[model samples]
Each structure stands twice: as structure tokens, then as C-alpha cells.
Target: MDNSNMWIKHKNNRSIKEQVDILVKLTETHKKCIGLPKSKREVEFLKILYPASIRNLEIGDKFIGKTDYSAVGFGCVTSTSGVGYFFHKHKIDELKNNTKDKELLEKINLVEKYWCDKDTQENFRKELKKSNPEFFKKFAKNDNYSCVVCGFSRLSGMQLNYNKLLDLGVNGLKKSILSRNKDGKNDFYRASLEALDLFLDIANHFEIETRKLAQSLIGDKLEREEVLKVSNCLKEIKKGEKPKSFREAIQLTWLYGVVAGVVNYGRMDDYLGEYLLDDLNNDKLTEKEALDLVKSFWKMIAWRKTVMNGRVTIGGKGRRNEKAADKFAMIAMEATRINKDLEPQLTLRIYENQNKKLLEKGLEVISEGCTFPMIYNDEVNIPSVASAMNVSLKEAEDYVPFGCGEIILCGKSVGTPNVLINTLKALEVTLRNGYDRVNDVSLGYNTGKIEDFDTFDKLLEAYKTQLKIHIEELAKAQRLSYDVMKENCSFIYVSLLIDDCIEKGKELLSGGARHLGGTLEVYGNINSANSLTAIKKIVFEDEKINLKQLVHILDRNFNGFEEIRNELLNAPKYGNDEAEGDLMASKLHEYVCMCIKESAKDIGLDSFLAVVINNHSNTIWGRTTLASADGRKKGQFMANGNNPYNGTDINGPTAMLNSLTKLKTDIHAGSVQNMKFSRSMFKNHINIINQLLEVYFENGGSQLMITVVDPKELEKAYNNPTNYRNLIVRVGGFSARFVELDRQVQKEVMERTLYE
Candidate 1:
């Protein structure tokens, strides 16, 4: 079919189900044609679509019908618009029963069966490659000769040495391949093939589409000019020469990703180390030069649309070569000082021996509000990861951030795509009989009338029942989306980078990746805190206010009730290690985890938990939620992602960790425990940092993100603002300048108890 005609057909579809079906089919066809399952990572990239696709198909309709069957089988026949109503699963059973098309039913069944089947992935890979040999060949040859950034030639008989490779073992080749493996195979040869295949597919798709998009958007002349610039950069790098300047290098790297189908391939620290070390040794690359290069690199990366989405990690404890990674981190921090852009998101790892200068630099960036370098505490994170996977310290150190802010052992694991459910939203739905103003929708299984409930426990039971209902629905949606993505979008490049794809002949998505599970971050648990506290104080404790009065006050944002607002604020809050607040946090986390776990089992996938209240916390979601009682004025900052509200946890970092330890990690999925330390704390008592981390992890800390900064400096910076422009803090997965963050977030960072 002509491209125009195909697009027209896609746009003209009438039924939402039909539109979804077409999307699924198009995805499957795309994978079958252009996809190659070279590695487990590649497969994972493919399998991640099932939940989203399923949800899209089931959106809006409360019951499944014949149209729903068509949607999942043939693809959606409508335009990709509307309220994402395509994701609702209200009528799944009805659709299954009503569908009379045997062929369509068979296709749906096949998709479902293959969602987690390794053998199916292997077959799909072979079939896809066989269908599009020419495309695959072109994709594979796109990058020839050598490493684009370092000019490390890949020519046969040419001996090459990279410190990164040596430190990572097998010249880093095995580690690179293993890192991409969606299925857990460590063999370099097999993993390489898989990784190569996945890389080629994704790269080719990206390259072709990007070229087409550029041409259409900018006209042929401009497109040609851009292409020429990229081509020149490629040629310059291939000549076994350094760029004339840092700007050239940055431009070259950006062009390389643009043309070569590799996005942000410069492990800057790894690639420029030789030059950096030489400069460091001879005092040739001054701090200014180092900083300029960092700035230049970010500018170039920001120029490219794709590179902006890429991530960079600076420090990892117990990495193949800890010393090298640490040194590289210092260089990266130096660079962050010069350039503070959002692209090339940088992460800094803090351990017992973190460089003080580097910490100051990071804080400087944070003080500027750029929020560039997010911090990770190796003391806590390393052990936490180790305990979760039961891997060696070295393996644990290899952990890297995946989607959102979850940690995965880079070279050795395949964690699930992020699946998020707002716990407070769920509670709201239950309270309103499946209607949520918070989310502006009705989503729940209407089991019965909840008005009959006479007690808080009965109300709680209804909420739990509702939670199970939506969770199960969502799990099914996740499975379907997984299948759709696996069949449509192939992860050729990812596969090549991950381990064991070629040997297993599986893609990353279909259980081939090391960690085979899904994680859901529960939001608005603090809302529950506010609600529970209000209920206890008003109905149970004070007896002066009833449930109606409390709800009325909440609806009013406590506008006329300054006294009540103060009371709620002074009341027990989560993260203070108070029994009332801590118990509520524990109950909410545990109950939510149970729902997710049970629902995940229904879909034949492992369900895990992660607490992500990062950037999303500050953003407005749904109409301003009524004023929360946790000292938060109405529309004030919700709990900082998963962490407690700013200044709420006053006891200390230890008390916060203790509250976290109450929940059983082994039983739940994974949780992120973020702690911010002042620079003064680091210098005065590094051992205290080490001991606290040990105690936290030993007592069941699941995941940790640590930020080191000086409170005095931070407060000073907040007041004066321009004195420290380079301050950085661990903001979720990546780092950012503290001063660049929204004021509320800045307050949150300042409020984190800096351990003494």
C-alpha cells in the first residue's frame, strides 16, 4: 500500500477497537518485516508493548464486545486521539464471548501465547530477518570500521586497547554484549549476534524515520545540509584524529548518533579518558577545558532530538574498575560545572570515599537549579542491589537506571517496564464508587453499593476490593501491551548491547531478559496519610468533627479552617518513625503490593513495587488535589515522589530508613529509598555515612539514591542564589542543578535530614 493510503486508512478508522487492532497488526507486521531478535534486550524492547496496547484496545468500553476482539486482532481502526480511552478494559469478557470471527480469535490467542514464550521470540526473530534481508543488511552496515567517538577501529588484525574493556573483562566486549542480553546468557559470541541484530533493527528504523521526518519538516535542502554535516563529522572521526576542538567532538558525536543509528554512543568518560588522563598528567586540559568539553557535549547532544532521551551514568561502586569510574565521575562533575543542560542526564554515585571537590561541584549545579547530576549512594545502593539479585558486588555495581528511575544490573538483567498506579487515586475511586475526580474518570469493578459501610474498616475493605479490581484489569492490559510492542517495535540495538540474545535466539521482552517482572510505583500514599490522619483526629480522637465535616473541609482546601489545617499538620506524619504514621505507610505500601502481586500473577508475570515520586510530584496531575493535611497547603507539593514531604521526617535519616525497613522487600517488588546528605556531613563523619548505609541495606533497604550536599551552603545559595551556580543533586534517575529545580522541590532537598 502507498504510505499516504495507509495513513489515510489508519486515520479513517471508525471504531476505537478497530483502530487499536490495526495498530497491533501494524506493530506485528513491522517487527516481522524489519525486526531481528539478536539479543534478549531486543526482545524486551519488543515485549514491552503488551500492557499499553491491551489497555489502548480496551479503553472507554466497560465491557468487551466483538469490536474489542477486532481491535486486538487486526489493529485499532481509529485515529490515535481522544482521552486514551482506548486503554480502558471495562468490557473484555463481553468482547471475548461475542466475537464470532474464528481467525481473529486465533490471532489474539497467538499473541497472548507468545507474550512470554522464549521459543516464540526465537521464531519471530528468524522470521522477521528472513522477511527483510536487504533492510537488515543495510542496517548492520550503517556503522562500520570503529568506535565513533574514540576512533577505535574495528578492522581485522588491528589491536585495540580500552581501559574500560580491560576493567570490565573480555576487553569489555563480553560485558557490552551481556549488558544487552534480555535473556540471561553470558556467552559473548551469541550475545553479540543478538545485540547486533536488535541494534540494527532499531537503528535502521530510527534513521529512516528521522530522515523522512527531517525531509518532510525542513524540506530537502535543509535535510541535505544536516546530513552533510553529520557525514563530515563521521569522516573526521574515521580519520583516526581528534576534533580540532571540544565543540567539534560534541558535534561529531551528535552527528554519529543521527547518521549511524546509534543514539548518544559516547560514554564520554570512557571515550575521552586517555586524552583526559594525559591532560590531567600534563596539566594540558585545565579545569576550564574539562568543564568546557562537558558543556560542549551537552549542547551538541541537546541539538539532536533523539540524543536528548539518552542517559549517562558517571559513578558506580564496585564497577569493573571502581577507580576509573570514580576518576571519570570527577571529570564529569567538572564538565557539569561548565554546561548545565537537561540532555545527557548525568548521575553521580556517592560512596564512603567520594571526592569532596566533586560533591561541591554537584551541589554547585544543584544550587543553580539545573538539577543535572543525580546522586546514588554506593554504600546503600550497592548492597541493596546485591541483596535483591543475590549477585556479586561487582555484578551489583553494574546496576544502571532503566525507565523512570528503577535500577537494573546493566549487563546482567532485564527488569520490567515501569507500571504506575496512584494508590491515592485508587482510594479515591473506591470512596466515590469507582469515580475519581483526582484522575477525572470512573475505573473500578462496581461490586456493590459502598454506602452500607458503617465503619472505617468496611470502607477500607471496599477500597481494597476496588484496588484488586483495577489492578487485575491493568495487569491484563499490560500483558496485551507487552505482546503488541514485542511484535511491532524491535530493539535491535538494545539486544546487541545486552547479553545472551543470540544464544537464546530470543528478544529482550519475552522473559529472555534477566529480571523477568513488572514494577508499579504507588503514588499518593501520603494522601492516604492525610486522609487517615484527618479521620482519626476528627472522628476517632477529637469527636468534634465527623467524617462529613472532614470531607467538607478537604473539599474546601481548609479555606476557613486554619485551626484544623494546623492540627492536621501537627498530627503524626509519615517518615517521622511515628507508629501511627509509619503504620499507615506500611499498611498502604503492603496492601498495594499485595494487589499488584496478585494481579500480576493472573497475567503470568512477576509484579514488583518501586517508589518513584521524583519530578512527577511537582507537576500538576488532575485538578489541584484538595489541600493535603501533611502541612501541605492545598495544591502544595505532594509527597516528593515516594519520599516523605519536605521537613516531615525530622527524627533523622536513620529514622526514615527504619520506617522503610518495616516493609518486607523480599515479599514486595522493589522500592527506591532516597537520602540527601549535606557536604558538611560527608566531611565531618564519612564513617557515619558508611555505618548508616550498612544498617539500612542489611535491614532490607531495596534501592537507594543518595545526594551529598552542604546544608549551610545550600541555605546560603538559596538566599544569595548566584554564589554556587554548579550545585547538583541526585534528582531521581539523573542529576540536576538544585537551583534549577522548582522552588518546592528545592525546599524538599533542603529539608532532607542531613545525617551528622
Candidate 2:
């Protein structure tokens, strides 16, 4: 192991660029960090030294270390990364023996003995699979056809309490830890204190390393100045003292995210705005400088290359420093515009009284085709979150969307969307009397054949019944999974940052948060609803074909029934503001929400909310779902989010919103609604776009994620990648390079209905 990199403790054995690409592959594959060190201190040091290369600092770079993303670095953290290695030693050794490279094989040989601490997330999952075979079987079987998914091996990010971190410096936090130690009986609190101690030790090491780097840059004036700026910033934060300037505060903010392993930043304007104000008031920092610092931070975040990166929320109702925060909010908006990187998933929280300039700035960025700062309406989310979490309206003001647009109480709750339920798959099962054609397996209760349902109501009822069974199984499995996680793994770093953990002497997973809950991802809702609507309009209302005949058409993949398939395709679809289709969409959405809520409530969760945010799973899951009544051929992508089936929203953007906003937004946690517009629309009428957004929120639209791009540009990029390496599009819940996306996803983006 080489000491120079310190983070990896070894030379790449691979090139840095190779490492960066591998890091993204690992994250996309496992949905968590790639490697897990044994101790908390080791993890902290790794974060401090990650991305392990800082030699090529930009002209205005104020931070020295940038994360290269060699290892997994995202929100979810199990107790140990390598515990599975211990249990599966033979599997590990077999691979090592198969390795052709001597060095790689030597590294793999270390897993010869199975070893892990007594309590670990890896062990907990093993236990869950062993002790609850029935639950495991259901979850595992769901994976093939992918009716559902769970956080068996990977973890998701949680919203942290940045307010607390800012208010109580490291020294103050240490004092709080000391006070908690007076109780001494709680292992959770003890672990948190120990975690904090390691955090501070790493802080000290960072200060030393930063100052040394500064010293080395003395020959170059500009580099020296930037390095010294970073060093001074580190010095103020190292002792756990309140940051005196914008630089220090931002520096600490970045470090906290790195050490915590949760990249979703909670309400940045609320926490860092005051520091910006102080610097400006004292004439120590200029507006341009502050924006530059923010831009650099944005670069640092994007450096990790997460498909769904950190979210930095700005401008909302409940910010403690609302007036002061507005200045930096505008700056943050500009930074996002300039950075143009897919990450820090810049989000803007808006209310009726929000500053007009800030709102305009955010719109301007989105109009530029950045697809950011994704707008969230406080008018709906505030009250909705309050009802969902059963907290006061004031408390709900702290609510923020983390990865892929799910709301959790920042610093007060832990709500991981650990399971995915495919509503359309359930509909398929209902139609086939519980048979899954794609996976060739029988699942759930047989709800009778489609011909047995004489009325449309009977068919919907059967679909609902099947959906309920899946939801119940998922909720029960999630409950057991979290319990095992709580028993085996200690989320020390997370507990230290989230609320009431130290105060109540408990860890995050062990009931330390003020609110504890989970979220479920529901895919194919729009497609299934549309299919149901088609069945109602064509089969029941028009009496064009019998249920059995339609089922037969779908079963044969519509090979010889092209006219029937076209009729179904032409049936009134969701997102068209048509009563027949919109009503069905509303009904299915409400039913899914109710089932999830009840199941989550039964398991003692604060709230079990459903998110319709698509993680490009519509494309992946489509491969596993057979043909449907909606004229969707086998292996075609499902609808993305609450949006209508691709190419179906024929009526324009307003009608799309009319169809989408029909849902009771307050009941479900979050949903993503994506709309694409041609560049001409922005060139023609900015006011019309603004008014459209205003009316949507007034009508109860919760969130709007927009992408403004020309279809020709994307097509050209697809064929000639080198000509436009920087072109990006919003794939689903997140954005990525146009050429880097899966071919099917790129096709989906092209097929999105473009409003001119």
C-alpha cells in the first residue's frame, strides 16, 4: 500500500480515469459505496483523501481535495462494507484463485477467514434471509421479473440536520457528547460519541495536510493564494468553532457531507446564507467571489459522478435566515447555471411569497436546458409533509427532497425508499389469474380469469386485490429488514447528525430520529392506469371486444391483432385531460397510496409514502413486463413517472398538467412530473411559461422537473458523440451525459412529447 494517496493507501493499480469510470459503475451496480473500511476513523480519512488527486486545481479553486469516486460514496451505509466477504469466504477465495493477476489475487486472498464485528448490516441481511425464508423468497422471486426491490445490500442517503452542525461546532458537539456520556447505558449514543471523536481527528489531519499543500505552492503566487485560502478555511473549521466567513462555512459543509456518507445536503441557503452575509457586510468577500466558491463546491459534488447526486435546497418558507438567505440563493442559482454539471441536483423551493428574482433566476436556469434547480412548491409540500409525517406545519417547513425526489424531515427523520412495487406487473398478474408470463411463474392469489370479470369494476377490484397483496408483503418484509439492520449495524455518523439521537441516546435505525418511516417506489402507475382506461373505453363502453379476446391479443404480443392494438393505443390516454383516462389515473394513484399508507401504519412507521419518481427503471423494468392492453408491446419501456406513456400526451403541456395534478398530492410523499419543451418555446414567451407554472402550483402540483432540449441535438449526439460530449438530458429522476445513457433511455428521451 502506498501512503501518498492516503485515501486508497495504494497506487491505482489502475489509471485515475479508469478509477472514476469504475466508481460510477460500482455505484450504479450496488447503489452504495464500493468498499467498506472496518473503522469509522478509516472511513473518515478515506473521505478526506478521496478523489485522491488535487494537482489540477482550477484558477478559483478554494478547496484542495476533490472526491475521485474510486470507492462507493453515497447515502446508504451498512455497518460494514466487507462483512459479506467474511460470510462468503469460499466464494471470495474461489474468485481470488481464478484471478489471472498476481497482485489482485494477493489482495483477494485476505478474505480467507470469515470475520466481521458482532453487529453489522451485512450480518443482519444474512439473518433476515435465513430466519425469514418466506419473506426472502417473495423478495428474491420479485427480483427476476422485478415486481419489487429491497435494500438488502445497498443503502440510501438520509437528510441530515445542517442547522445543528452549523450552530454547534465540533467542540460544542464534543461537549454534548460528554454530557450524553453521563447516562452511559446506551450503546447507540456511545457509538455516536466515538464517531464524533474520530471525525475531529480527521479534521485535524485535513488541516495539516492542507497547510502542507499550501506550503508547496509558494513558488506560484495564484496557486499559493488559493491554497492558503483553503488552509485558513480549514483552520477555522478544524477546532469545531463557528465559521467566520463564507469560505469556512462552505468548507465545513463539504467536509460534513463527505464524512457522513450522505450527500443530500439539507437547506443550504438556510445554513450558509448568514455566513455569506457576514462576509459581504464586512467587505471581505465580493458577490462574484461567493458565486465562484459555490461553483467550485458544485464541481466538487459532481466530481463524485453519482447518477443521483447531492441535493442542495435553497429558498423556501421556513428558512430561519430567509431574508439573508435570498442573496446566496440567487448566487447558488447562478452557480448551478454556470457549473452545468448534473450534480448537486440543485433544487429550488418556492412559495407564494418567494422572491421574484430568485424564482426568475431558477426558471432561467431550467430554460437553459440544465434541468435544474428542479422546482418544489412549498405551498403543497409543506402541508402535505405535515400531514404525511403527522408533524406540525412549522416542523414540516424543514422538509426537503433527497435522492430522486422523496421528502423526509431534514435532520429529524429517516425515510429510505427501500422497496419498489411495480403496479403494472400486478395488473398483469390480475389479468392472467396470477400468472407472470415474463418470468413464467405464478405469483399472488388467483383473481379469476379476465373473462370472469363481466364489468370494468370487477377488473379494477381484482387489480386492487393483487396490489394489496404485494404491498402487504413488501411492508412486512421492510419492517423485518429494518429491525435486523437496527440490531446489527450502528449508524454512528448518521445518528450524530440527525435529530434527537444524542438527546435520546439512540442510534438512527434504533428509533433515535423524531420520525422514522420508509417510502415505496411505484413504477408503471400511469401505464397501468392508461391500460385500465383503454379496457374500459374499448371493451366495456364500446363493446368492441370481449375481455378474453383482448387478453389473448396481449398474450400473443399483438402479432396479428394490429388493428385492435391500434384501437387501444388511440383510446383516451392519461395526460390528455380526458375524463375517462384521467379518472382512472387518479383512482389507481389513490388506491396505491392508500394500500401503502395502511401497510406502513400497520408496521409502526410514521408514514409510508409512495414516490412515482422514475430511476430509469421504467426502461429496465419494461424488459421484464409482457405486452399490455394499452398497446404497449413486450419489452417496451413503461411510462416514466406520473407522465403519460411516451408519445401519448398529444394535447400540449397544459393538458398534461391537468391530467397529472389530479392526484391528491398530500397523501403520497413525492412524485416526479417531467415535461420537455423545444427551445423555440423559451425564445417566444417567457411570461407564458411562468404563468403556466404559477397555475400548476395553484392547482396543487407538487413538483415539476423540466427538460428543455431539441430532439435533433439529442439524435445527432447519439450518432456523433464526440461532436457534443457535453450535451446532457434529464433521464428520469436525475440527469446524465447524452451519450453516456443506456440506448433505450436515450430513445425514451427522444420520444418524449416536445411542446413548442
Candidate number of the best lDDT: 2
Candidate 2 achieves a global lDDT of 0.73
Instruction: Give the winner by TM-score.
Output: 2
TM-score of candidate 1 versus the correct structure, residues matched by position:
0.59
Per-residue error for 556 in candidate 2, Å, reads 1.4
21 in model 2: Cα distance from truth in Å?
A: 23
Give model 2's TM-score versus the native structure: 0.89
Q: Which stretches of candidate 2 lie over 4 Å from their true place?
A: 1-61, 64-107, 112-128, 141-145, 148-155, 183-185
The clash number for model 1 is: 119
Worst 10 residues of 2 by lDDT: 1-10
Q: Stretches of candidate 1 above 4 Å error?
A: 1-295, 302-310, 351-372, 386-394, 416-418, 437-441, 447-453, 510-512, 559-566, 597-601, 622-636, 646-756
Candidate 2, residues 667-740, lDDT tens digits: the string is 77778888888877865788899889999999989898888877588889888888988886887778878887
